[model samples]
Target: MKKIIICLAFSMLTWHSFAQDIPVKITKSELFKDEYKNSNIVLVEDDGSGGVVIVRSYAGGIFSSGYGYYFEHYDSNLKLLKEYEYQSKVKKEDKKIYRSILGVIMNGKEINMIEYIYDKKLQSVTFNALTSNINDFDFTSKELFNMNSKDAESGNSGKDRDAGAQMIINEDKTAFAITVDIKDKNSETHKIYLFDKALNQKIDHTFKRDIKDRKFIYENIDVSKDGNTLYLLGKVKTDEAKKKKDGGRYQYELTRITSTDEKTQVFDTDEHYAASLKTIIFQDRLTCIGFYSDRNDSRFKGISYFELDPNSLAIKKSKFNPFTEQFMIDKYGKDKDKELKNLRFKQLIITPQNEIILNAEEYYEVYTHVMTQNGGGYDRWTYHYDDIVSAKINSDGAIVWARNINKRQDTSVYGNPFFSYTSTAKGADAYFFINTGEKVRKIRKDRIEFKEASPKRSNLTVIRINENGDFDYREVLDDEENEVPFMVAYGELTGDSVFFLGQKGKKKQLLKLTL
Candidate 1:
C-alpha cells in the first residue's frame, strides 16, 4: 500500500471564485499510483457530513471473472482519510459477458458496498448480489437468483430482456426492489420482488395487466418512509396506428405494492406525448413530472406535472402545459414554433426561497455506418450534447424565469456522450460547469454557435446565472495555459462547494472548486 497522494497546485486554491476562493486539492488513488492498466473500473459516490464516500471496483473486461473493489473516505478538502480494499470471490471464468454495478451505502456505523453481477441469457437472467462491509473489510453476503425475461421458451423470440433486470436498494438498507418484465407462459407480464436488509425475499408478486400490444419501460422505484410499502413507476408503449390518427403514446403507470396486495393505476396523456416520466417522492406524497410533445413525436413542446397519493395512486391535482416559451432558437438560425427539441430534464431542485428550479439540456443521437467488404457494417451512434436550460418556477406551477446556458459539444466515439454539463445552486442563484472546445467562439447572451473541439483543447467554463435570468461566463480551467483537466461537469455540488474528477493533461485527481 502506498500513501497515494500527488500534490498539484492551482493558481488559487482558496475558494476559487469571486465570493471566496475554494481550496482545491487532488487525491490519487492506489490504482493510479500503481498504474494498473488491466483494470475495468466502476465508481459509486455519496456525500456525507464528514466527507464523500466512494466505492470503486476494478476488474478485467467481459472476459475476466474477478473483481477488486475498495472503499475510500475523503474529507472536505478531498483528502483521503481512510481506505479499505475489498476482496471478491467471483473469479470463475464462464466465458460470458457479465455486467457489474457498484453502489455506496451508509448503514448505521458501517459502510456497505453492493455489487451486482448479472448476465442475460436467452430466456432467463442470472443475477448475483454481492455485499461487503467496508468498516470490517470483509464479505457479508453473496446471493444468486434466476428470473424470466424475453420469450425464450416459445422459440427464443421476442426481445432478449433481462428477466430480473431492474433493481433498487433503498438508501437506509431497509428494503430492496426488483422489477422485471418477461413473457411468462406466452403472456407479457411483470414481476416485483421485495427483499429485506439481509437480502431475503420478503414479497414476490406478478403484475396482472393486459399489455400484449404494449412494451413496458421501467422508470423509477421508491420505498415508503415507514418501510411498509414499495412503489414502481413506468410507461407502456405501442406501435403507430394511423387510422385513428394515433401515432401511439406511452401510457403512464404507477404501481403500489404492499406485503399483501398491490394497486396499479394506468393512465394516458390526453393529447401530448411524454418524453420521459420521472417520479419524485416526498414525505407526504409523490409527484411525477415530464416534458411533452404535440403528438407522438419525441420533441418537447411543453411541461407536464402532477402530484398523486402514494397509497391510492390517485391524482390530487394535475397541471398541463405548464411551461412558458423559453429563450431558445432552433438550429436553423430562427426561433421555432415551440421549445427546442432534445431538451431532457434533470432532477428538480428546491431552493431556500421555496422555488422549484428545473434544469434541462439539449441532447440527441445520430446513427451512422461504415462501408466494408461485407457491404455495410452495423449502425454506430454519435451523441451531441448542446445548450442547457435552468428555469425558476413558483409554487403555483408557473414559470418565473428561464435561463439558457449556451454550448455545443461533439465526439466521434460512441457511449461517451462526448461532453457533460451540470449545475449547482446557492440561495436563488445557480452556477454551471460546462465543457467546451478550446477554440469555441464566444456565445452571445441570446445566441450560440456550434464548433468542434480541437484534440486536447477542451476547457471547463464556470457560468453563474442570477435570479433575473442573467448569466456571466468565466473560463476558469484552460488546458492550454495550465494542466486544467478537461472534465469539470462530473463534480458533485454541495452548498457553495463543488467537487469532481479531473485530469490535468494526463494526471488524474479529485478537484474541489468553491463557488
Candidate 2:
C-alpha cells in the first residue's frame, strides 16, 4: 500500500510537467552584416515556398545618397539564400550618391524590388524583378512594370518630389503605385497606377480635389482581402465657416474603390476629428469596425459597424453611435453632475465570433487636498490624469463587460502606455497592458493591480481572456533579476506555434510560445 501511494504521487508530478506550456526557442542569424549597422529589417512574409524575403533599409549611409539598401532572401530555416545589391552608374566628384529600396513583393516564382536612387546628375527610381529560379524568372516578360525617379517626379511639385510616392501589392500579385503631384498653381493631385503581375501597366487613373488652405498629406491605402476593393484613409482641411460652425472641425474621409467604378464612395466624418477603419472577413462575410474622435480628445465618441455586399461594393445596414447609455452609466455611475464626458475610443478589435472589443480613454483635471488635524492649515493642488477604459460588445451592439483601467492617484503616461490584445494559436486571446511612469522620490508610481512590485522602470501585465471577456489566467513578465524593458510589436499564430516580435537589449527579437 505504501509503494502504490508513492507511485501515484510520482505519476501525477510527471503529468503536470508534461502539461506545462513553454516559450519557443529563438536562434539569431546575421543575414546581412557589412558597413551597415543598426539596419531596419522588414520581414515581408514566409512564402510557404520555403523562403522569406527581407528588405534592409540604410536610413543614411556614407556611400549611399538615399535611405534604402537591397533585397536579401533566406531559406525556411533562415539560411541566407541569395542577395541582389543595387549600384548606380552615374559618375560624381562630390560625396557618394545613395539609392534606397522601398518596396518588394513575390510575383509567382520571381521577386520584384523597387528602389529610389538619388545622385548629383540624376534622381530616379529603379524597379527590378529577380527570381531565385533563374530559368523560370524571365527578364523579357512584357507583364513587368518599372518606373524611374523621373517618372515619379513628373507628378510632384517643387516642394519635395520624393514625399508622396507609395506602392501597394494586391493578393493576385498586382501592384498599385500612388503618387501626389503638385500642379502649376501649387494645388495637389493624386495619381494611381495599376500594374499586372508581371509589372506591366494595366490602368492609370488620376484625380484632383480642392481644399481650403489645406495641403494634402498621404496616409495609407490598403487592398481588401477579397482583392477587389481598396480603402484609403487621409485628412483634409475645412473652410473657415465650416470649421467654426463645427467647433474647429476638419474633414476626414474613408474612401472605398472598386474595379468597375470610376468614382470612389467617400465616408466623411465631422471636423476637428480623425477616424480609423478595421475590416475583417470571417466565414465569407465582411465586417468593418470604425472609430472616430476629435483632435484633442482621447475617447472615441463614435463607433460604427457595417456589413458589406462584396459583389456590389455597397454597405448593407450600418449602425453608428456613441457608447450605449446603460454601459456608460453602469461603469461610471448615473450621477448627472459626475458624468464622464468627452471620452474617445482608441482601439477596436473583432473576435472570431464577430464580437467587438473597444478600448477608450478620457482626460480630466482633479484637485488634491491635504488636511492637518493639529493647528495647521490645509493645502490643495490640482493635477490632470487620463482615465483608460475597456469594453466588450457583442455583434448586436450590446456591451458584455466594461471596466476602467486607471487607478486613483496613479500618474498615467500620456501616449506612452502600451496597449495590445492578441489571439494565440490555441484559440485563446491574451491582452497586454504596459504602463511606463516617471519615477520620482524613490517611490514606484504605476503598478498592475493585485500583482507584486513590477519592474520599477517599466510594468507589463498579460491576461488571457475568454471569448466572452472572462479572465482565465494572468502572468506578470517583470522579475527582479530580469529588469530589462521588453515589448511586443507584432504577434501571429503560425500553424500550431505562436510567434511574437519584441525587443530586448535594444535589439529586436522574436519570441515563440508553444502549448
Candidate of highest TM-score: 1
For each candidate in the order shown, give its overall lDDT on alpha carbons.
0.58, 0.44
Residue 150, model 1: lDDT of 43
User: Which digits, one per residue and each the tens of the lDDT, describe model 1 over residues 45-88?
Assistant: 44446566665456645665456665667665456677776654
lDDT score, residue 423, model 2?
A: 36
Instruction: Provide TM-scores for the models.
Output: 0.77, 0.60
The residue-by-residue lDDT of candidate 2 on 116-166, one tens digit each, is 444434554444433333223332312233344453544235464334456
Instruction: Give lDDT: candidate 2, residue 102.
Output: 45
Which residue segments of model 2 deviate by more than 4 Å? 1-37, 47-98, 108-110, 118-163, 169-188, 196-202, 212-219, 234-260, 266-288, 293-299, 306-315, 321-461, 472-487, 490-509
